[model samples]
Target: MNDKREVFYAKIMLFGEYSVICDSMGLTIPYAHFKGELSFINEDKYTDLEFAYESNRQLKKYSLYLQKLIDDGELIFEFDLSSFKKDIDKGLYFESSIPQGFGIGSSGALCAALYNEYGQNKIPNSRHISKKEILNLKKIFAQLESYFHGVSSGIDPLNCYLKHPIIIQGKADLSTVGIPRNKHDEKGAIFLINTGHAGMTEPLVKLFFEQCKQHSFYKSIRDEMIPFNNNCIKSLIKGETKEFFKNLRGLSKFLLKNMEPMIPETFKEIWNIGLDTSTYYLKLCGSGGGGFLLGFTEDLEKAKFELKKHNVELIPVYKNAKVIDTIKNI
Candidate 1:
């Protein structure tokens, strides 16, 4: 406990943006390229004092809320407020690289790091944590993170907490499954398309919920959107690579057509072009005001050519790993 410990980076849903809410499957992987660390600091050198002070101020407010919950018997464990207060006074803060609203779970990582470092209930071995407990923990973390974003799925924090690949079957059914083998030879791939603007997920998600008030939108989502999402998940899980991308194309189109207003105006034309060109299909990765737009392509080379005009930054993630059997069992 004396040594400083760092939590590894968390890779979020390679797919399943909003579809997962209604029970569509979600796939997540852990990426080590970005991460956060927790440490005990000696109050001597103060370089980024201003930033630290602001972060501490925010953390203090959250901690007080948590303390209140514990006092009301809502939370099960007692929190060590004295030590937490001292750390805050010394300018303690979460140091992170995970981007917010890019859908990689930056806030989730922070919550996980804090829970790991400060939560009184000891982390029993991961093996000892039951499925129910896992879900419950995710729920708790999600609630904690709602302070940042109005509503949270908790999947981000859950992935950060577990630091492993997790698959969601539906709202109530979630489990960890093995990933299929990644075919390095396949020219087909999935990628992140930089939208050149940072998106605010809370606002976008709120808009979606507001739109859901309309019966037509709600019905379309339940009928068209959810089915497309489920099929995409199935195709991907079953190693049906061709079918997976095909379904993604359908999903991208559906979103563009039905969820047009949700997409930022800047990305509208490009999104439509991708669909019409049939070279690549673009969909919202998270809430999508800006940030990264998810894309699927049958031929990466052609997709590159078609997208060259946009000058978008294409980041490859699951180049080789496309299906379910590729990952090792838990």
Candidate 2:
């Protein structure tokens, strides 16, 4: 049996897909939808034992790889796997509700939970770390998670590590930021519309990379995406939300026109309707295929009405119109 520890949930980046790779602005939050906690179990809990066995089977393989990195001097912090293996045998599986491949950081949450409970150095929450230290931590976490999604953003793991809203400006340029507050009950809110199918990040990202190899597509991404992402950040920062949506709409169209095949065939009509009707602006939440689609609207009711015909699951993001706070008391 081990001590109890709470693991925080992770949210999705509503925008900034491939664009974020090119030094574009990206934003993310910690969704409180699900969480996991560490707890002791009697040796008699066979079900927990079984789950732990399977999880250990997966984690051990990664630990071996991490050990190799440590041996090669590539990784600094090295965890003791012996006790962790023993704990797994004693029933230490994660009891979590975060759904995988749903644009939410399920694997990332698990990685954070494991690191918090078992890592060697264990970054301190009470003590502030340098930006370089934070990025180094992120790189280590990302290395631990490369097995899940071929290439790791390291952002998801970093968010899970920090358990806070993060703003990404470019490669190696990230910092914790506050969520804008909304107090006026403004109908305009960011939302998630479920497309009813799970998305595979690897394949979708692979496709985008292949597309990037093309000269014309590469130019559009450089010229269009980079500018739109910067503008969107500026607008949101300056409280010019109207301009934010306008740029979002533009960015959405650019994705539609250039990244056509990435949009699922079934949802193309609904995707068009959003742009055509001006009801809401739809964009990929994360490697979109059949997972949750991000929507931006000034009128939630109208967006709901316009989107009623489609079997889309709408999730309210922010309401009541307030700027996002960067720091919050624990």
Candidate 3:
């Protein structure tokens, strides 16, 4: 491209996907392997002009949505709509490698890139977002990301903007935090498996809402699921490997028994095998119907062997130990 700037990285909500809405603990971290940035089309750097044109068109639609937010007084910060239009007309597009609907914050990266480029006044993307500034950014990002997923948690976008590991204690509590360091040869790991298709967040979210209408289902999540979710986050942060896996198994089993629809149909058998053998445990990466399924194990080699029979492979995210302030190879 002629020009590219303002990079935004992908995010993984490691724990507390849907339960975070219920005021439960959630943890997220930036995944530098996938990212997006603002770029111009008329350049010798790219071989795919059509992709850039399509991205430009999508950005045009998003700009229109943002304009409406401004016109209706819903926008809280200074966004330069006029400048944004000029760039779009000149063939501005998002150059990205992040996969959409993968629960890896593709749209969140786009939002971060856009806001970084067009926002006149913005929250500093500081590593130590140890103050109330996190909440302000969350609120703004929630509104910006709503255009993609009808109801946004804003956590994904905030994760992209901050580019740090964030711990969410509840609705009113969130701050960037440190994670334990891992060795290259460590056995315990966090990993992912591709489910072979994209999952629609809107539909899955609607399904979750519908399920919540049933008191029994909601109570199950509150009493059963949230505890598992919260404890996993707690143990992982504290570097309590034994405790983390204990809670992770609980979380995976709970998903298998109750939130089955979130797990893709084809992988259900394999998911069961993980729980039965205790070689590994699979959980919803995000709103999981089909996309990436998050997996955890105390032993990566054993998990790989178990997954091989299913014709699947695990991609390790974190290994050994250590919370990254800025991410490197996982």
lDDT (C-alpha, whole model) for all candidates: 0.71, 0.72, 0.86
Superposition TM-score, candidate 3 onto the true structure? 0.95
Extract clashing residue pairs from model 3: 179-323, 180-322, 180-323, 181-321, 181-322, 182-321, 182-322
Write down the lDDT that model 3 would get. Answer: 0.86
Model 1 — TM-score against the truth? Answer: 0.87
- TM-score of every candidate: 0.87, 0.88, 0.95
Write model 3 residue lDDT over 250-309, tens digit each, in one string: 999999999888889999999999999999999988899988999988888999999998
Report the Cα lDDT for residue 104, model 1: 69
**True-vs-predicted CA distance for residue 161, candidate 2, Å:** 1.8
The per-candidate count of clashes, in order, stands at 11, 17, 7
Off by over 4 Å in 1: 40-53, 76-80, 122-129, 183-185, 321-330
lDDT of 2 by residue, 1-330 (tens): 346576767667755777876667887777666565443355344345665566656666766766677688876576766776677666566666666677778788887777777787787532255677777777877876777888887788677667776778777777776545553237877778777778888998898888888998888898998788778876775667778888988988887888776677888888889999998888887777767778888788889888887766588765535324422321
Off by over 4 Å in 3: 1-4, 182-185, 321-330
Runs with alpha carbons beyond 4 Å of true place in candidate 2? 37-57, 67-73, 126-129, 183-185, 320-330
